[model samples]
Target: MSVRKQQLLKQHRRNKRIALLAIIMGLLLLGFIAPLWLLPLAVLLVWVVHEAWFADHLFYSPQDDYQYRFPDGVQPLSLRLVNGRLQLQESSLAQQATVIAKVQINSSWLGRWFDPSICIGNDQQTFERGAHGVRYLNLTGQVEALTTAGLAVQGRFCSIATQIQLYVFTQPSPTAGNMMILAPHADDAELAAFGLYSGANNVSIVTLTQGEVEAEYYQRLGLSQQHAAQLKGRLRAWDSMAIPLWGGVAQTHCVQLGYYCMQLPKMAKQPDVPFASQQSAEADIRTARRHNTIQLPGDATGLPTWQNLLADLAACLMHFKPDVLVMPHPEIDPHADHIATT
Candidate 1:
């Protein structure tokens, strides 16, 4: 920014703050004070005034930035997204550049109200500063790679970071080879990568859990929580194994590990501790195992512990010896299990 622009922005903010204080003073002079019993309503009235003044500049729904396009050279960023920095050039950024990306960062409701000043070179813009489903980032005359844009999503840690692609990139075609697809739940394999490896040869689908925690999905069947959960697992497990047949995977190639849903990270964290299923209340995976086509590899623990899952997954890998492996991107997938699957 030029010295003139910087001065103007500073003056602008100072004016807003002064104006806000003036409003408060004016209200007080106007005898706007309320009785003690109306304290809650008084606070609400003050908040209304503040929001009305900030409605145009401070608040924005990030989801509104759904569609974005970039000029013809940017490709799929080849560099690692270590933190939020899009490390394009090895040097510091030049003062002038362009908005090369339309990014959608997952943030909390509170975070949405406050802009995350994304830094690209010396240019730092916020999600509220751009339009059309993308956060504009500055990237041009590279002066340094030391600069960065970081996201501190409120309410929770970072979740899915979906963004529109502005860069140009090529993808290779899938070929015949030993390939394995690991689904954290029943349909994840299909939703996350059906088109990715459906045409590939020698594909194996490995479902880690029966998704027993989704028992609420079967509540209409007039069954108890445990029965409904167990039933959902059985049905979804079959969907996980059988649906891929249409995609050309051999029926025998699909297998289920028969663990509970939403409990994977816990199982991994407490590998030795036996965590019972919240839905089934059963301390074992025997029910889910009944739907498996492939046997547990090696002397599998068959217990609901993290070590057994790791051992089972390792054995499956050895059995397939896949040339290519497919799993969720821990940084991108929203589900915790999907993140743990990787």
Candidate 2:
């Protein structure tokens, strides 16, 4: 046997032993520590080793034939795994494996000794917010089969059905705080309806953080012929790498709420004093109109600053129906406007 093959064999055996030990120790530790915390890592290690063994075997033999299959309307994915880079592209819509793609990898010294990533685009959902789509993974034996076949894959493979709704607005606008829109935090009924809590495959909204999205990338997050053309060239798309455990997905409409929310003036010190006498109040309404602001009504109400601000806020909230409303407490800092708005 070649020296390289001999070395690979030894490494494979060692990995197997380590994986076995992890499983055994993890199970034993479950008695003392929370299984929820330790078991996932343990399982991940087992998967890594099992995949590594197969990958080495495949790497050692290039002549072994392989076949990739997919269901109808289901597209095969092209993944390139070179070093630590993972590139995934959607195959032709024909629903068959006609191309072999690789994922990119970045392997460091420590990674080589520990766990090295094989695939890069697993958790990627939509390319942009409000664009309804997801990269679906079929949890059949094929992925594991591929991993064992000497292809590098990271993490556990579970099958999930994916669908996405891309909501795009042709006219682009800036959002307040650069926060990505999120679905309203799920209520108990929503959780049940979406099967989120029950672990069923229902459509649950997820909101990526601000960093995950680039608003300038698309004219509107909604579907566009220009974007459609772009999709035509690419094989696959992935959501940017998000901190797997820290971020979540939610749906959001693109607009600035604070644009209107901030316009509300603080209540006057005397509740009975009408806002008509306040120069800031009159200027605020005019400024809002010139800016094409959606909140201010032209009908003049001779109410106090506080009353007028509250009425304006109520209207803005009703129109926006913000899933998460962000309001700054001016009272804490005591800005003249803040004091009045509060």
On lDDT, the leading prediction is 1
Clashes of each: 13, 42
Global lDDT scores for all candidate models: 0.65, 0.33
Off by over 4 Å in 1: 1-176, 298-301
- Estimate the TM-score for candidate 1: 0.54
In candidate 2, position 211 carries an lDDT of 17
Which regions in candidate 2 have their CA more than 4 angstroms from the true location? 1-268, 275-284, 293-295, 298-304, 329-336, 339-342
Error of 1 at 271 (Å): 1.6
| Local lDDT at 90 for model 1 | 30
For 223-339, candidate 1 gives per-residue lDDT tens digits of 999889878888887888789987888777887887788888897788887666778777666666665666774235557778888878888888778878888987557688888
TM-score of each: 0.54, 0.21
lDDT of 2 by residue, 261-290 (tens): 122342245444443321122322232222
How close to the true structure is residue 342 of candidate 2, measured as C-alpha lDDT? 32
Q: Compute the lDDT of residue 81 as modeled in candidate 1.
A: 46
CA-RMSD of model 2? 22.7
| Residue range with the least summed lDDT across 10 consecutive positions in model 1 | 151-160
